[model samples]
Structure formats: C-alpha cells, structure tokens
Target: MLVRVLGSAAGGGFPQWNCNCPNCDGLRRGSIRATARTQSSIAVSANGVDWLLVNASPDVLTQLRAAPALQPARAIRDSGIAAVLLMDAQIDHVTGLLMLRERSTPLPLMATPEVLSDLSDGLPLTRVLSHYCGVAPLPLALDAPQAVPGLPGVTVLALPLPSKPPPYSPFRERPRRGDNIGLLLANPQTGRRLFYAPGLGEVSDAVLATMRGCDVVLVDGTFWTEDEMIRMGLSRKAAAEMGHLPQSGAGGMIAQLDRLPSGVRKVLIHINNTNPILRDDAPERAELTAHGIEVAFDGMEIAF
Candidate 1:
C-alpha cells in the first residue's frame, strides 16, 4: 500500500493569508527554516494505480498539481483518483468537491451517514455537485470493516472519535456518533495496517488499540500546546474546545503517542499555522525527532 501526503497543514495552511503569526511571519520573511504547506489531505493506493483520496481539502487543486501520481496520464481528461473518502464535513475538508465538478464521470464519495447528511442538506456540497459531475455516495458503515470499492486488497473501518460537528451542522452542539471519525486502513494480504485520525480531539481506548495494532499512525497535530491560539489572541477557544488535541502537555497527543510500541511509525498531520513544529531548528521539531515522530509534509510518500 502507498500513502502520499498531499497537504499537511490544517485548515488555513502555513503562512495563512490573514495570519502574520511568528511561524507564518518568519517563514514569509525567510527568517525561519521551514516548509510552507497547504491544507490537510492524503491519497492512498493499493496498487499505485487506482487511488483513494482521504479528504478533499480546499487546496485540492494545488495539491493535485504537485502530485503526479494523482494525475492519471492514461488518457485525456482523466484522473487517477478512483474514489474520495471523507472523515468529516468541515469546509476545509470538503469544499474541493466543487473543484472536481469538471470530471466526465460521477465521483465515488464515501462517508458516514451523519457526514453525508451534512453535505446533502446543511452544507449542500453534494446538492451543488448534482448538476455537474454527479456524486455516487457510498455509506461507510462503522459496524465492521468493509472493502473500499475500487481499491482492491484495501479495507476501511470507521472508528468513531469524540468531536463536535462543523458550526453549520444542526447538531453542532449535540455531538453524534458519526460526526467525526478516524479510519483504519488495512491491507489484508500484507497484514500491514494504518490508523489515520487527522481531526481527533481526544484519543479514546479504542483509538489507542487501533494504533497499537497498526503499523503506522497518522494523527492530529493541529496545535503544539492547548492554549496556543488563546495565548496568541487568535481565538478564544483552546485546542480541545475546537476539536483538536494539542501535541504537548499532560494527556496530550505526544504523551499518548509515547505509549505506542516503538516499531509503529508515528506521524503528525493537520498541523495548524501557529504550531512551532514547522520550524526546522525549533525545539518542538527536535522534540518530535527525539520521540521518533515525524511531522507530515506535502509530497511525503509512505509505502508498506
């Protein structure tokens, strides 16, 4: 199986247009050793031909242009993506479907019932796409592991996480079962598994078990500390209040990850613009290296 990191930053991307935070300002001024990144998303391929796009980020267009593997060179007006599987319905995660409206065929879109409802009703992305390049919705049932259509040998199981829905969702305050989720992608043939949870707010016992069993774990790295945005006066809410687990401190992502077996390859994704891990020489980045954790970057490829 091959996993490619299309974009690794959170919703705003690094050096976000409106943000001049230290990391963003430093990178923009060429004063920091860091790589600029786009929004969070990834592509998975079982045979390196047909690919499954995990999330269709707002930066999808630019992300695809940088990924030659996602460009089906077989024919004119073609795409390598066989299907799109979404974990949630945040604007940053699903708006790119509009960009794909030019496709000659309907899009194979998969998500939980709740997520599907949001796009079909409140968000209405699916409704808009219906006019052009229609969508074929595949309900991802969390009862058990099911084969991801189009990607042979690859199976996906939905693992529910504790998280709030997007503000536009009617049930934003009343969290539901499928509102947010992680995925367990398994190659039955190779017995190599990957656990992906890009927007996780907290790591539950089930989540930990899945990580322990998987060969690789790519989890939320949205904030370096719980009060990151609060300290910077960017937002009133702390990292936990916004449905993300900070990387440091007690009961944080890093502490939880340290408990995982050493053989499991651990990586952090969905990094926010203010996160200190973006700098090459920052202590935060060095700390991750010391703990054997990698910060996901655009164009990163992992094959197992």
Candidate 2:
C-alpha cells in the first residue's frame, strides 16, 4: 500500500491569500521559516497503480496537475479516481469536487451517513453542485469495511467520531451530529494497515489499541495549541472546540503521543499555516522530530 500526501494544509491553505497575518506576511517575505501548503487531501494506491482520493480539496485541479496519474486518459469527463473516501464534510475537504464536474458520471464517494446527509443539505458541495447532476452521493455504513471497486487488495473502514456543524451557521438549529470520521485502511496484499484521523477531537484508548499493529499512522495536526485560532483571530473557538489536538503546549500532542508504544511511526497531517512548526527552524519542528513524529508535506509518500 502506498499513501501520498496530495495537499497538507488545513482550510484557507497555508498563507491564505486574503490573510495579512504574520505567518502569511512572513511567507511573502521569503522567510526561511515559512512554508506554503495547499488545502488538505490525500491519495492511497492499492498497488501503486490505481489510487483512491481521500478528500476532494479546493485545490484538486492543481493537486491533480502535480500528480500526472489523476489526469483523465481519454478526456477530463472520465472518472480517473477509483473512488473517493471523504474523512469529513468540511468545506476545505469537499470543495474540490467542483473541478470533477466535467466527469460524465457520479463519482463514487465513501462516507458515513451523517456526512452524506450534511452534503445533501446546503453544504458548500451540494450548493455549488445543486444545479448539476454530475456528482452523486454514496454513503458508507459505520464499521463496515468496503472493498474499493478497482482496488483489489485494499479495503477501507469508516470509524465514527463525534462532530458537529460550525457554530455560526443558521443550520446549527439541527446541527450535523456524528458526521466526523477517521479511516482504518488495510491492504491485505501487502499486509499493511494504517489508521488515519486528520481532524480528531480526542484520542481514545480504543482507537489506540485498534491501531496498535498498523505500519504507519497519520493523525491530526491542526493547531499547535487550543487557542491557536483565537490567537490568530481566525475563529472565536479553540482548536479543541473545533475537535482537534494542538501539537504543542501542555497536554497537547507531544504529551498525548508520549504514551503511544514505540514503533508506531506517527505523522501529523492537516497542518495549519499559523503553526510555527511549518518552519523548519522553529523549535516545534525540532521537538516533534526528537519525539519521532513527522510533519507530512505535499508529495510525501508513505509505503507499507
């Protein structure tokens, strides 16, 4: 099994275009400590030939351009993706589906029922795609492992996690409940298993034990501290409130990861722009390295 990091940044991308924040300014100044990243997305290949896109990022076209394999062989309307497995329904995660509108048939999407329901509503994906019938919703049941149609050796398992809608939305009235999820991927042909959760709220012991024997783990690296969004004025809530763990500070990622058994090989994904760790010179990066954790970058490939 081969996993590729297509886009490693969280929403708005690293150094968001309209953002005037210090990080954004630093990136523009060509500071060595700053790095630019596209929106979050990943691709998993069963035999390194056929691949499944983890999420359809807003930068899908560019990401696809970066990887020659995603381009349509005959025309852009063909379904180049074997299938798409959505980790969540966040705008940053699903906006890229628009670029696939040129595809003639509905793209097969594997996701939880709640997530499918949210997409059916006025979420960004449905709203933009409402006028067109290009994309169709295919929901996956929790706990049931589904064999990807084209990927013979790989099977994807959906693990339900607690999640809700944005607090500011009028849709908050009913609020999407239990939509968030993590993935447990396995390639029996290669005897590889990976536990992936790029937007996790809490790390449960059950999940830890469940993934104990996996070869590689890609978990959330959204913020360095709970107050990251507040400090940046991007949001009024903390990272924890948004259902993620800060990679820094007390009781944060370092501490939580400390308890994991040796040899787990943890890598952080869905990194935010404001996190100083994005800078190779930052102390946070060094700390994570010393602790045996890696920060995922675009184009980084993991094989197991």
| Best candidate according to lDDT | 1
TM-score of each: 0.98, 0.91
lDDT of 2 at 304: 76
The global Cα lDDT (0 to 1) of model 1 is 0.92
Candidate 2 per-residue C-alpha lDDT over 10-62 given as tens digits, one digit per residue, 9 for 90 to 100:
88888888887777888888866766889989998866667899989999888
The local distance difference test score of each candidate is 0.92, 0.79
Q: Give the TM-score of candidate 2.
A: 0.91
C-alpha RMSD (angstroms) for model 1: 0.9
**Poorly placed runs, candidate 2 (over 4 Å):** 72-79, 124-133, 166-177
Model 2 clashing-pair count:
0
lDDT tens digits by residue: candidate 1, 1-304 = 9999999999989989999999999999999999999999999998888899999999999999999888878987888899999999999899998999998989999999999999988899999999999999999998589887888877889988888889999999898999888988887778899988999998888788889998999999999999999999999999999999998999999899999998999999999999999999999999999999999999999876
All candidates: CA RMSD (Å) = 0.9, 2.3
